[model samples]
Target: MTYDFQDRVFLITGAASGIGRATALKLSSLGASLALCDINSTSLVTTTSLCTGSHFTHSFDIASSSECTHFIKDTISLYGKIDGIFNCAGINPTSIPLEDTTDEYWDMMVNTNLKGTYNITRAAIPFLKSGSSFVNVSSICGLHPFPTFAIYCATKYAITGFSKSMALELGPKGIRVNVLAPGFIDTPTNSGVIAGEEGVKSLEAKVSLGRLGSAEECADVVAFLFSDGARYMNGSVVEVNGGTAES
Candidate 1:
């Protein structure tokens, strides 16, 4: 479907790579003005260079509520208004037993994955008007547990619930909130998790499509969520997992 966003403005986190970069490029192609952020300044600049249309990039920690507040201020200062937000900044650590996980690890994961999303939402709420969309990136693990990934799963699950509640709270204002539960996508974020070719095959076996999803494929969904095509969708959890099934 064609989406024309000629004058719309969007805020995207984790814009350096993976689904975030892909979504930035997608929205840019659709003529949306963008405010992109990531902790990785270098790669974020690279992603900006690759996109079309007017865009601004910032490097900051989304886990910091203060930084997140500053980010919204900067974006509103530049664009005057926000029409959409994509909360994609997060961490994905490899599987480790619950006993092996420590409080520090839990803190890091929750702060980055869960708190980061909350920070962005809270900061942007006032500026978002009717018809605005918010798409938060969760994971298949959020719905289905992954052994040895308890901490990560906890963060994602929290995002799902938080986003749903926000949808309920914001729906009356015409601001839509939704989530993307992506499976094994072929992105840098998952490069370390998939091991080698054998591991890839093993993972693919769990997906009915017999292949990992792509960042661009997920980007398409984000664009749709922000477009009129999905205007009626709110508080929805759309899974882009290539039909992944439980073992």
Candidate 2:
């Protein structure tokens, strides 16, 4: 099916950076209005400014339940409906032994990665018009094992589970829920590795495609996932890591 997103309203979290930023730009270029939320107002404003029309921007912590409530309210107050939602805001701050993972770190990662996705989706459920789409951003770590990333991986895995259940729950309303699992996408956060010569070598070898991925590449998939093109795709997990996931 043709993916035409013209005049659609797309709500995206973590819109300030990386795949989220790229997807927001891509969607806006396709004639979609946007509602971007991020903890970083500085970059968040830049994202909203790039959108097609009177796009809205809200600076709120994804980890906070109350803030999510406010952000969703502001979204509908600014735009009557939410046609698509991308839960792109997340973090990876904890990297320790299972025992060393502090209560604070564990909570932070869990709240941001898991609860953040939940809070946003919960808040957006009402305003999501029928036939709308929700794409949750999960990582390949959720699919594969990684050293010192136990909690992070657990959270991403939870996304897949939660998304599937949500798809079934929202199916009657014609709302679709799916997961986007990306691998080694080169972004500012990972620039240290992907941009460096040695790190690049290591990353390229790990990918079955013998290369790293780009934010735009990931964004392209997201654009389709949010469009009518994905009308038949619900409760699916799409991995855009250039065969790395398959390997």
Candidate 3:
């Protein structure tokens, strides 16, 4: 099904790569204007070059509330208003047990994965008028526990909770909020997990689909959540994990 976003403006964090880049391209194909940001300036430009619609790119760390505020402000200045937001900026955690997890590692995950989502959403609230939608990128780890991914799971679980609460708070204003929990997707971050024969089988064994998902698959769901087609979908946690986990 085609979701029309013609002329609408969207603000996407982490647009340099992975799901963020895929979502930006999907929206662009649907005729949306975009305001994209990421810490990697080179990759951010590369993403822009692949787009077919009007877009503005910025480089900043979403963990900094001030930088997020500034990026939102600049986006509004450029597009006049924001119709949707994709909070996709995040960091992957190391496979360290909780006992071995240092304060620095914990802080980094919380700041980027949890706090970064909060920072961007909080800053964009004022610009997001009635009918605006938000799609936060969580993970299957948010819904189910995984060994050695304690900190990452914690942040994702927090995101699901946060998005649900925002959905409730923003519902009266006609704004919608939802979270997407993706399973093993083939992205740069997870390349190691699907590298060798043993690695691929090890990861695939956990998925009912017997293979990893694609960033574009997740992007398609984001487009739906942001589109009027999902007008009634608020406070919903949608999983795009190829049946890796069921609720």
Per-residue lDDT tens digits for candidate 3, residues 1-247, read: 7787887999899999999999999999999999999999999999999998658998988899999999999989988999999999998767788999899998889998999899998999987889899999888888988898899999999999999999999999999999998888888887445366687677778789999888999999999999888999999999987777533
TM-score of each model, in listed order: 0.97, 0.93, 0.96
TM-score of 1: 0.97
- Cα lDDT computed for each candidate against the true fold: 0.92, 0.85, 0.89
Q: What is the lDDT of residue 200 in candidate 2?
A: 78
Q: List model 2 lDDT by residue over 29-66, tens digit each.
A: 88888888888899888777766666788888888888
Cα lDDT for residue 147, candidate 1: 88
Model 3: CA > 4 A from native: 191-195, 245-247
Candidate that would win on lDDT: 1
* Consecutive 10-residue window with the lowest summed lDDT within model 2: 186-195
lDDT of model 3, residue 3: 85
Between prediction 1 and prediction 2, which has the larger TM-score?
A: 1
Alpha-carbon shift of residue 27 in model 3 (angstroms)? 0.4
Off by over 4 Å in 2: 1-3, 191-195, 245-247
Worst 10 residues of 1 by lDDT: 191-200
Residue-level lDDT tens digits of model 1 in 1-247: 8799999999999999999999999999999999999999999999999999658888999989999999999999999999999999999877789999899999889998999999999999998899998999999988988888999999999999999999999999999999999999988778434587887788788889989999999999999999998999999999999999953
Ranking by TM-score: 1, 3, 2
